[model samples]
Target chain A: MPRYRAIIAYDGTDFYGWQVQPGKRTVQGELEKAVNQMAKNPEIPIRVQGSGRTDAGVHALGQVVHFDLPYQIPANGVRKGLATMLPFDIGIEQVDIVADDFHAQYSAHTKTYRYQLSNREFRAPFRRNYTGYWPRRLDYDKMAQAIPDYLGEHDWISFAASGFQAKTTVRTVTDVKISQEPATQEITFEFTGTGFLYNQIRIMVGVLLEIGMGTRPVDDIPRLLAAKDRQQARLTAPASGLYLKSVDY
Target chain B: MPRYRAIIAYDGTDFYGWQVQPGKRTVQGELEKAVNQMAKNPEIPIRVQGSGRTDAGVHALGQVVHFDLPYQIPANGVRKGLATMLPFDIGIEQVDIVADDFHAQYSAHTKTYRYQLSNREFRAPFRRNYTGYWPRRLDYDKMAQAIPDYLGEHDWISFAASGFQAKTTVRTVTDVKISQEPATQEITFEFTGTGFLYNQIRIMVGVLLEIGMGTRPVDDIPRLLAAKDRQQARLTAPASGLYLKSVDY
Candidate 1:
């Protein structure tokens, strides 16, 4: 069996998430179906593991997945075959042959996640479908100032989504960035880290937004981190704004 | 009543066409509903007349439409208000008050229509939803060489869609140009004319494509036009590639 690594992108609107679930549309399910059809034996099972298990309606630009093929096929041939078989929205952006032991999810070194905020009264017709439409003014300078506070390793129990279970909450965030797009009303919160807990980016976005909306002060982020309780965290932002941008290995 | 002209852009995947139809999701119908909601009068009876009637799944960037408003509203206000009430894929690109005698469809001096062609074997995941995908290789030089033959006054009867009935087949094409996007697998054909018959641009694209694909000669365009029969034309290109880019009034 030859192992292949594929970079994928999806709209995430129709899909439940990246994981495979019975009777649900998912990125994992779509890719696996295509892989199985191409395999020499129809009965042979092929499982794909994604770098990030994104939540429902969360999109990705650089989602990495690994699957083993029963027969060796050129990477470009596999790409074309998958493109022909996959649905219009879910597509394999790039395919490459990898070492047999290479695992897309496990071998990932760092992942960059982005949460977008459209701080405008009216949403751009083209961008509204994918971004969160926030009809409020934001103090971007204050948001940028708060970035360094969340940069180092910390226990993010306060930012975890409801019912989120993890072995440990201590995670190293290498960088935290808040920036605005040129000539647009979009504000993006980018985080590069070793890994992330469930819904942590969205929760942090909500807290930053609360600060933007004058409901919380810039100093409150540190206090909230110290609280180590989900109750102290602001509301979770919508999944539409979050994107797994890239995985570095 | 004050008549206003609006420039529009849309992704036609979800729309039936530009005309108002019963039991179909049409562009005119959506605009009419939004107008009625804003005008707030049951008997106002606003009909948005389009510069050209596009077929189902055809996109538009500068489609012009006119409607009579019983009461005066700021142009900017109407633009913003209608945009807020409408869906994301449809938008008012421009809105302004024109002369009382102005008609969107009839008062135009010239119109420009653009058709997109995907020039690669592998399809893009995000673009497949909006653009027509083809697997065949295209010769841009041959297509570009053939564009000028369709430039001047002539009866473009053969280039119209089957069963299309317009009062006159004689039309003056101002210019026809083909260009490629830098570093992308997208080709664009822009056609400018004083007026175009129904489905004229689409059929021209088809003939151009057939020539590029080695199915027809570059000189076949004039030969088909001389035949003056709709059956002599090549296939009517898919609607996904056609766009009503602009209208000059």
Candidate 2:
């Protein structure tokens, strides 16, 4: 048996999430179906392990996953098979052969996620689908300055969702970047870290949004992280604007 | 009554086009309802007219519209009022006082619609929502060559959707500019015309697509326009990739 790794991209609108459930379309189920139907051994069950799970309406640009096959299907053939079998919105970005023991989640290095915000009084119609549209005035420079505070190892329990009960909330975020594209109303937040707690990106965006609006001081980010209480952080940003941009392993 | 022209933008995904209809959420109806509700005179009615109708899933960056008001409301008030009163997807970009007889549709000089096509085998999840996910091979250089055939006064009945009963199918398309953005698979078709027939932009894109894929000769465009039959055209692209980019009055 051989193992193959794939980079996936999907418009998360029609999907329930990455994992499939009964009666709902999901990225994992689609890939499994496509692989099983096309592979030499149609009976071979595939366990497609993704880097992480994204909420509904969120998107992925470089989501990494891996699965084992009973026969050798060329990397390009695997890509073409999944692409032809999947819907127009979901696609296999790249396919490569990998070690049998290679696990997408465990063999990992760092992951990066991006959240896009439209800082304009009126949102651009074409951009509204992917960006979080907020009419409030936002100070982009201040937000960019405040983004660095989230770097280093910190107990981000405050930013975690109330429903999320992780054993360890401490994660080392190597870099956090928030930038505004000049002459345009688009602002993007990029986070690179070994791991992230549940709802971490949403909460980080929410806190930065508060800072951008001048409702919170830049220095307050450290205090918020120290609080370690979910209620201490700002409200979570909408899922529609977040994306699992890349998984660098 | 003082008439004010309002520049509006909206994400048309959840909208049932721009026209008002029963059991459908339309941009026109939402704006009209919001304005009519805010009117000082409850008995009097108000209707908002847009520069043109944008079909469902189509976007607009510079769409102009206006409606007469029973009493004078500050431009800022109109912006804040409709934004707060109406749905979050639609927004009033700008507002100003226009001439007494200013009609958004009839007063328009040049209406430019951009037809976006993505020439990539793998559809980008991020861009799939905005661009038409065209997986076929396209000779962009050939597509550009076909533009000159549409740059003149010609009957565009063949470009229109069937059952569009118009008084005159003849429309003077002053210019048709097709440009490809380098380093990406983005192809933009800018149609600057006095007016467009129903589904004209999509049809024009379809003709270019045929030429791009080598299905039809680039020289056949002029002959197709002269034929005045919808069957002569290859196919009409989807409405999601079309945009009313600007309306210069």
Candidate 3:
């Protein structure tokens, strides 16, 4: 048996998420089905592991995953087989044979996620699926000033969803970059961290948006962190605007 | 009756074309339906006139259209009303009251059409609907060199579709601009002409693509034009890559 790693990209509009739900269309489920059908023995089951589970409607540009095969197949052959079997919305960007010790989930050192905001009065028909539409104007300078509060190690329980089952919410965020395209009125927030609690990125984006809109002050981030209650950050940005940008090991 | 002019935008993936055909979804059909439903009296009909008919699966960024209404409605009111009645894929970018003599199709002085080509090994899922994917690399310098042959007035009959019903095949191309984004391997061809024959832009794009791919010599354009036979330029690029960029009155 050999272990193979791959980088994947997907539109995520029609998928439930990266996890395999029993009766729903999901990225993991589709990938596994394609691999099994391509394998010589149909009865032998193969499991695919992702770096992390992206919520429903969350896209991915470089999502990393790993799987073991009963027999050795060239990485390019596996890529071609999956490309032929999978739907057009999903793409395998790169495939490589990795060391036996490599694990998609446990071996990951850091991850980067991006949230896209379309701050325009009217949403373009073509961008509806990829951006979160915010008709109101935002204050970019204020948002930038507040982003540093999220840096370093902190308990982000307030930003975690109520259903999140992570044992600890303390995580170290390495970097936060905010960029705006004035011509298109699009704001993109990139966060790189060791890991994130479920729904943490969306909740953080929601709060930052409120700050940018002047509904909340910059100092409110520290207060929310101190509260450590999910109710402190009430709004959770929609999953459509979120993307798993990359995973580093 | 008052005449209203509007700049329209739409994602043409789900549309049959800009023409109204029974039992088929079309941009013109949807516009008429929205306008008539918003009218005080639905029994009295109103017709929407487009600058020209776009082929099926072709998109528009600034398509121009005009319609006459029995009563005057504020431009903002009309825009809001149509926004509610129309589907998400369609949008009225701007609306204004125009003189009674203005006609969408006849009053246009120049029309600009854009063709987007994605020259990439693998198509990104996000751009599937907006670009024509070409897996092979294109020589931008060769394509640029061949564009000058399309300038000025010429008989473009060879590029016109077989069923074209236009009275004359001689049309003047005012300008042609070819630009490539090296990072994304996307090339955009913008053509501003007095008018275009039926299927002219698509056919021109197809011929230009061949020239870029080195299958046809740069001088082949003049030969094809002199031939005056449609078979000389056989390929018609897919409608998905074409856009009605703008119409100037």
Candidate 4:
């Protein structure tokens, strides 16, 4: 058997998530089906391991995955086969043969996630699926002033959803970038960190949005971090606006 | 009765077109339903007139329309009422009470249309419904060189679809602009004109795409215009990429 590493991208509107479930349409399920068909192994399904699990309606630009095949195939052949077999919304960006030691989940060192919001008077019809709609006016400068609070290491238990199974709630966040397009009124928030707890990014964004909307003071972030209680940050942004931007190993 | 003029936007992927048919979903059909609901009229359906008809799957950014209501309603009231009644895919941008003589179709002085193409090695799944996919490298400069021929008045018979009911194929195109985004590989073609024959913009974009792909010479545009034969420019681009950008009164 040979192992292969691949980069994948998908529009997650129609998918349940990145995990394989018995009766749901998922990104992992579709990828595994394509891989098994290409290898002509209908008796068994090859398990594809993703770097992380994304919630339903969460998109991805550069998701990393690894799988073992029953036999060896050329790198380009594998790419073409998977591209042809998978659904139109899921795209196979790159494929390469990798060493047996390259585990997609364990070998990842850092990951980046982005959340987008449409800060317009009304939601634009074309962008309904790709961005979360925030009809109220947002103060960009206020949002920018609060972004630095999310940097560095912190116990993100307040931002994490209940029932998350992480060993520790502390994670090192390396960077946070906030940008807004004046013409389109689209605000994007990007976070890069060593690891993230379940629903942490969406919760953090919800806090930031409240700050932008003037409902919460700019200095409220530190208080939320100190509380270390899930109730402190209860608003979780919609999954449609969240994207797994990249994974670095 | 009071006349109202409104600017509208929509995602046309699920619509049959702008015109109303018995069983098909259409933009006009939805707008009329919303207006009549507001008017509380069950006896007869109010007629909504669009600046022009758009083909199926063709989107709009600033499509103009007008209608006469049986009773008076504030502009803001009408806007909010329609917004609440209409589906999420269609948006009412602006509304104003206009004079009784105002007509959406006859009062228009100029209309601008845009056609977009994604020129990349592979089709981006997320942008499938918004742009036409051309999985080939294109020379933007070649396309730009041929855009000047489309400016000024010309008989666009070669670009018009068969069975068009326009009295004459002659139309004055006031301006043409071509631009490309290097990062996203999105090419946009914009044409501002006094009027357009049926399917003219899509046909012209198809010719421009062929020129950009090196299949047809840049100078081939003049020959096609002179030929005045519909077969000379038979490739009508997909309606997904066409947008009625604006209408000026």
Candidate 5:
């Protein structure tokens, strides 16, 4: 069997999640269906593996995936085949033939995630679907001062959601960046790390937003980390603002 | 009666156009519905008049409209009231009480329309609704050099769509501007004119796009204008990429 790798992007507003569920519309399910229809034998099932699962309403700019085909087909051919079959919300950004040893999840070295915030008095209707609307003015400097606390290796148990089933909560966060576009009144937070527990990014964003709004002190990140309790960070930002930006292998 | 002027914006994907027709969804219809609901009396009808009628699938960033209310209401109150009643795709950017004599259609001086082109080999699904996908590389210099031909007052019959009902095609085009965002591979064209005939902007954009793609010569603009026939400029661009950007009083 020939192996192929693809970089995918999707507007997750209409999808249940990245994983396949019975009678539900999902990114993985749509990808698999498209692949099966394009396969040499439509009756045979084909499995599509993703780098990680994104929750419902979470978008992706460069999600990586891999799968095997029973017969040979050019990478561009696969892309065109899927492009016509898949829904408009999901797109194949890039496709290439890879070695059999390559794995979408195991071979990943790091991943980057981004969360978008629209900080304005009135949320623009066009942007409501792509950003988390925060009507209050935020202290950008205060938020910047607290971002450094998230750097380095730490047990992110407090940041993870209650239903997270990961065996270990320790993850090495390599970088954190926050950028504000004053013209558009948009704030974007970028996080790069070896891995993240389920819902960790959203929780961190929620706490950071609280700090920016002066509801919490800038030093609360360390306190929450030390507590190692999920209740310490109460708010989980909405999934609409989260994006699986990119993955490294 | 108190007259109110408003700057409206909307994503026109689901709208039939700016005019109201029986059994069809229109921007005018939605605005009227919202205003009528907000009015002091629910049974009485409210008429919303736009500066001009935008073709179906055309969007707007700063469309101007006015309506008379049987009772006086604060500008902010009307905004707030309509905000809850209007659908998410349409929004009011500004509202103010105008003189009783002011009219949305007759009081207008100059109008500006913008056309967006996504000049990339592969169309981005996210931008599909907002831009016309032109997959070929265009000569920006040639397009810019030809823009001057469209300046000043002239009969634009060649640029008007078939079955246009305007009494005269002579209109003063004060300015024509073309800008390209290299990073995003997007090109925008803006035209400021005293007024426009039906489908004039979209037809002009279609000819300019053909010129940019090297299918037509840079001097063809003047030749087409001199032809004084709609068939000379036959390509009418899709309404999806057109926007009624602004109107000057």
Candidate 6:
């Protein structure tokens, strides 16, 4: 058997999420089905493990996954074959045969996530599936000033949503940045970290947006982190705007 | 009665076309429905007349239309009401009341159309709805060199598609430009003219792409125009990549 690792992209508008569930369409389920068809073995089924799960309607640009195949095939062949079998919304960007001990989930060193905001007065029809809408003026300087506080290692319990059973809340964030396009008024938030807890990025975005909206103080990020209370971050940004930008091993 | 002119945008993937057909979803049909709902008058049904028809799967950024209502209403109110009633794929960008002589189709003016091509080794899932796929390298300079031949008044019979009733084949092309985005490998061709025959822009794009692909000569534009034959311009670009960019009154 040969273990193959692949990087993929998806629209995520129609997918339930990245994980497989009975009677629910997901990225993993669709990819596994394609892989099984290519394997053409009824006795042995192939299972794929993703680096992490992206919630419903969250897109990905370079999601990594590892799976074992019964037969050895060239990486390019596997990429072309899987692409032919997969739906139009999911794309296989790259594939490589990896060592038997390599794992997609545990071996990942860092992950970069991005959140997009369409800060316009009206919702654009073509951008509905890709960006979150914020129909108000945002103080860009205030948001930028608040972003640095999120860096370094901290217990991010305040930003994590309920129901995720993580071993520990301590996570190291390596970098954070925010940029805005003057022509479109689209704001983007980028974060790179060792790992993120469930809904942490979205909850953090909610607080940052509040600060930009002038409803919350500029120094709210440190206070929220110190409180370590999920209730402190009252908003969780919509999943449509979130994207897993890349994973690095 | 108040006559209003509105600039609209649409995804156009699900629409049959810009024109209304029986039992078919269309941009015009949807706009009419919304206008009628707002008018709330059975004696008179409001009809929207677009500046021109965009084929199925052809998007628009600033498509202009004009319609009359039974009662007087503020321009902003009409824009907001119609936007609320229309589907997410179609958008009302700007609306203004105009004089009775103002017309969407017959008004004296210019129209701009743009075609987008995703020139890459693989088709991006997210760009499927908006860009035409061309999985090959293109010579940008060659395409740009051929563009100037398209300017000035000429008999554009070679570029026009069949089945259109036009009084004359003579048309003046005011401007033509080709631009490429290095980061995304997306190429855009924009054309501005007094008017265009049915399927003219798509055929023009086809010829330009052939030039870029090295299949046709860079100086082929003049010969094709002189030939005055549609078959000489055999390639018609996909409708998904075409956009009615704007209209000038």
**What are the models' TM-scores?**
0.90, 0.91, 0.93, 0.92, 0.93, 0.94
* lDDT by residue for model 2 (B1-249), tens: 889899887777778899999999999998898998778546867888899898988877678998998878888888778777877678677888778899999999889888888888776666665677688999988988888889888889889888788899888888788888766688888899989988888988998998999999979888898788887885988777888888888
Query: What does the lDDT come to for candidate 2?
Result: 0.84
Full candidate order by DockQ, most accurate first: 6, 4, 3, 1, 5, 2
Task: Show where candidate 3 strays beyond 4 Å.
Answer: none
**On a 0 to 1 DockQ scale, where is model 2?**
0.49
* Range of the 10 consecutive residues with the lowest summed lDDT in candidate 5 chain A: A120-129
- Stretches of candidate 2 off by over 4 Å are A39-45, A226-231
What are the lDDT figures for the candidates, one per model? 0.85, 0.84, 0.90, 0.91, 0.90, 0.92
TM-score of chain A of 4: 0.97
Q: Which candidate is the best by DockQ?
A: 6
Q: Per-prediction DockQ, in order?
A: 0.52, 0.49, 0.57, 0.62, 0.51, 0.71
Instruction: Compute the lDDT for candidate 4.
Output: 0.91
**lDDT by residue for model 1 (A130-155), tens:** 78888788888888887778888888
Q: Fnat of each prediction? A: 0.57, 0.57, 0.41, 0.57, 0.35, 0.65
Chain A accuracy as TM-score for every candidate? 0.96, 0.96, 0.97, 0.97, 0.98, 0.98
Task: Output the worst ten-in-a-row residue range by lDDT, candidate 4 chain A.
Answer: A36-45
Using lDDT as the measure, name the better of candidate 1 and candidate 4. Answer: 4
Model 4: runs farther than 4 Å from truth? A41-43, B163-166
Better of 1 and 3 by TM-score: 3
lDDT over C-alpha atoms for residue B173 of model 4: 94
Best by lDDT, which number?
6
lDDT of 6 by residue, B193-214 (tens): 9999889998999999899999
Residue range B1-249, candidate 4, lDDT tens digits? 899999999999899999999999999999999988889975878999999999899999999999999888999999888988899889999999999999999999999999988887766778878898777778899999999999888989999998887778899999899998988889999999999999999989989988988999999988888898987888788888999999999
Off by over 4 Å in 6: A40-42
lDDT of residue B153 for candidate 4: 84
Place model 5 in a CAPRI quality band.
medium
